[model samples]
Target: MPSYAVTGSSRGLGLGFVQALAADPSNTVFALVRSISSAPKLQEFVAGHAHKNVHILQADNVDVASIKTAAKEVGRITGGTLDVLIANGALMHHERNKLMLDEFPDESVLDDDMLTFYKTNVLGTIHMINAFIPLLRAGSTKKCIIIGSAIGSHKLARRTEFTDNPGYAMSKAALNIAAVRYASKYRSEGVIFLTITPGFVRTLQGTPEEVEKFFSEAEAKIREKFPSYEGSITVEQSVRDQLALISSVTIDRSGDFVNRDGKNVEG
Candidate 1:
């Protein structure tokens, strides 16, 4: 059985991944959320669909101990092996979407925001990998996938002149580097560490007007970057494409940062 663990599986792209993976009864799916109460949607889906293969575990990304504990539970359940570890937990403050590096109110505020992003997006993911490495090493498909963003790609940023949300972008870039380092270290052990963007996924949840306004602003920004760009994809489509890419990718392409199409995002 292909056993997988997805962090931040309470909602959005993470929830979509859980739904897709759990659909296959043969696949053992672990949905790691901050708490069961916080994941009503996931709980509802599991209960409604009667997906016996889906396991929900509390795992806050900022808490290394929580992640380690969740890993232990997964190891126990999966016989000390895990096929995939999907690190999807991240901090993306929509309010800060338009804030440039120097546009912050003050240096202190900027530092606080950047540090918060770093703690979750970079350090937390590193700790998660550390906690799950043993189980992954013993698994059949040892793939560690980090959900990255195009904003993190220096080449994409330069090409599109999309310079905003510096903290989020910087943290994601650091995460990409972390994945590459892990790939290098674990290549000999046949563990593939990859960073992939889910594309422009429309995972926003809010009032209808709020959602509309958010997408309008986002589309404007996207148009500024790519004139011919279309709208965002559904979370389901994005997860499907990503899972397909994950299944086909080999160790040779391990350290790559790619999009849903399996093309390098840096290009």
Candidate 2:
């Protein structure tokens, strides 16, 4: 059976990916969540499935010691061979403090707020891959999937009106570069690193209702400034598309900025 590891599987798009992967009879999914008891949906899904393939491991991304311990546990389970690994945890701290830049540009990035995002989005992801590198190397088709966003695309920023969150966008952009670099270094070992943007998905992190409310307040101003605003997609649709793309990944396709639509996204 193919063994898979995914971060942030407690909820949102991560949970969607876990569910889809678990549906496959030949796959065993190791979901790294913050807390098992708090995640009723995840617990329910795993329980109702009546299969032991779905393993939920507690993981606080910011806690390096916790991640290391969990990695060791997973290493034992898979015998140091993991087929798939996903860096899917993310945060949008900038949304709450739009004036943060104006108030504290110099101190903002270094503050606890932005540092938390980096710890989870960037550093934590690095730790996950590094600790699991040995396991991935032992697998047949070693693939590392890094969840990114269209907002991080430098090309999109230059041409289109995609996103305005500098902290979140910049972090993802940096992640893309790191992913590409990792892919280039390991391409010879049949390791595929795919940087993907799952699209604007409505997930547990932010409900569609909340997004609607936000849009109602800020949408007109955004639309007035940038005349081309493509709306969001459902979480299910985005997850399906992302899973399809991940399924088709190969060494030749590594280090590419890919979107849910199977086309090359610029960055």
Candidate 3:
């Protein structure tokens, strides 16, 4: 069985990945969660499934010690080998991050947002990669996939209308750089460091603000910009499409950033 470990498996796109992976009994899935006991949907899933391959382990992205412990447990469970480690956990301070340079928020808010975004989005990814390197080295596939955003690319940023989230974009850009560095450092050992953007996955589900305002505004803009646009896909579809794209990545493609449709973001 191919062993898979996905961080932030408690909700949204991460939860979708866990569900899709666990549905296949051929895959041994590790659902790394921040609070497995408190995550009702995850708890329901674990209770409902009769499959032995889906295992949930607790780990907070911002908590290095917890991630280390979780990594050790995964290593032990998978016998020190993992086929894929999806570094999917990240923080998004949307409103503050979406502000333009001249429209920057208050100094305190900007500082705090940038700091927390980097800590969780960038450093947390590095932490996952570092903690899992040994297990990856022992694995057959040795693939380390870091989830990223198209907004992160400098080429994409040239279109100011869509690149409004300067802070979040900057953080993701740094992450892309880090992923390339890691790929360069580990390529000889057969480790593939890849970054994939999931496009827009409709992250907010039932929140009133999201339903009434956020998604509607986003959908309107998408239709206006792209004539063929169909708003945002469900998280399930995004996960499904991304999994297909990820399966095609090879060591040669390591550190290259691509979107859900398998197109490179940099271009």
Candidate 4:
């Protein structure tokens, strides 16, 4: 059986990955969440999917000790091996004050937000690399997959970019480098570290009128940027596509950054 562990599996893309991977029944999934109380849906899913080999582990991506402890538990259960680990947890909060750097109205907000992004997305993810190294070393495929954003690409910033997402973009860029460094270090051991972008996924649903207005503006920009693009894909489609990409990746392509469609992003 293929053993998989995913962080931030309580919601969004993380939850989708868990659902898709566990559907095969041959995959033993460890869904690492922060806490059971904070993950009611995940808790319920675990209870219902125990027969499906879905186990929920409590761990926070930002909390190193928690991750180490969870990893130990999973290592014992899986007998010291893990096939795939999806580091999907991040700090892309929508409520943070937007900073444009040059035209930002406030400086303190930028300072605080930058630290938050670096700590969670960059440093915290680095900690995961350390905590899970043993399990990856013992696993079969030894794939360490990171959920990165298209905004992380410096070339994408020059070609096409979103407004007011500096923190998210900056942190993601840092994470890309961190992932590449780890992949370089472990490549001789056959560990495949891939940073994959899910490509413009429509995660937020809205009313008819509201949706029309938003998509009209967003889709127009997307079409203007990539003429061949068909706009945002559904979360289910994105997850399915990403999983395919993950399975197909080889040691030769390790440390690469690509979109959900299997295209390489600019370095």
By TM-score, who's the top model here?
1
Worst 10 residues of 2 by lDDT: 93-102
- Name the regions of candidate 2 deviating beyond 4 angstroms: 93-97, 105-110, 160-163, 204-208, 215-230
lDDT, residue 68, candidate 4: 93
Off by over 4 Å in 1: none
lDDT of 4 by residue, 1-267 (tens): 999888888877888888888888889999988775788877777678746688888888678899899999999999998999999988775455355766555787668778888888888788877888899999999999999998889998888766667888999999999889988999999999999998776655468787677667878887788888778777799899999999999998888998886788884
- lDDT (tens digit, per residue) of candidate 1 on 1-267: 999999999999999999999999899999999878989999998887765999899888799899999999999999899999999988887577678988988999888888989998899889889999999999999999999999899998788787778889999999999999999999999999989999888888889898889888888878987898867888999999999999999999989999889998876
Ranking by TM-score: 1, 3, 4, 2
Model 4 vs. true fold: TM = 0.91
Candidate numbers, best lDDT first, in rank order: 1, 4, 3, 2
lDDT against the true structure, each candidate: 0.91, 0.80, 0.84, 0.84
The C-alpha TM-scores of every prediction are 0.96, 0.88, 0.92, 0.91
Q: Put down candidate 3 lDDT per residue, 1-267, tens digits, no spaces.
A: 899999988888888898898898999999898777757787788779878688888888789999999989998888888899999977764656557756665778778877877888898889989999899999998999999987788875664357466777878999999999999999999899989998777777567775768777877875666667666778889998989977877898887888888788887
Which RMSD does model 3 reach against the true structure?
2.0
Highest lDDT, which number? Answer: 1
Judged by whole-model lDDT over C-alpha atoms, candidate 2 comes out at 0.80
Task: List the candidate 4 regions with Cα displacement exceeding 4 Å.
Answer: 205-216
Clashing pairs in 3: none
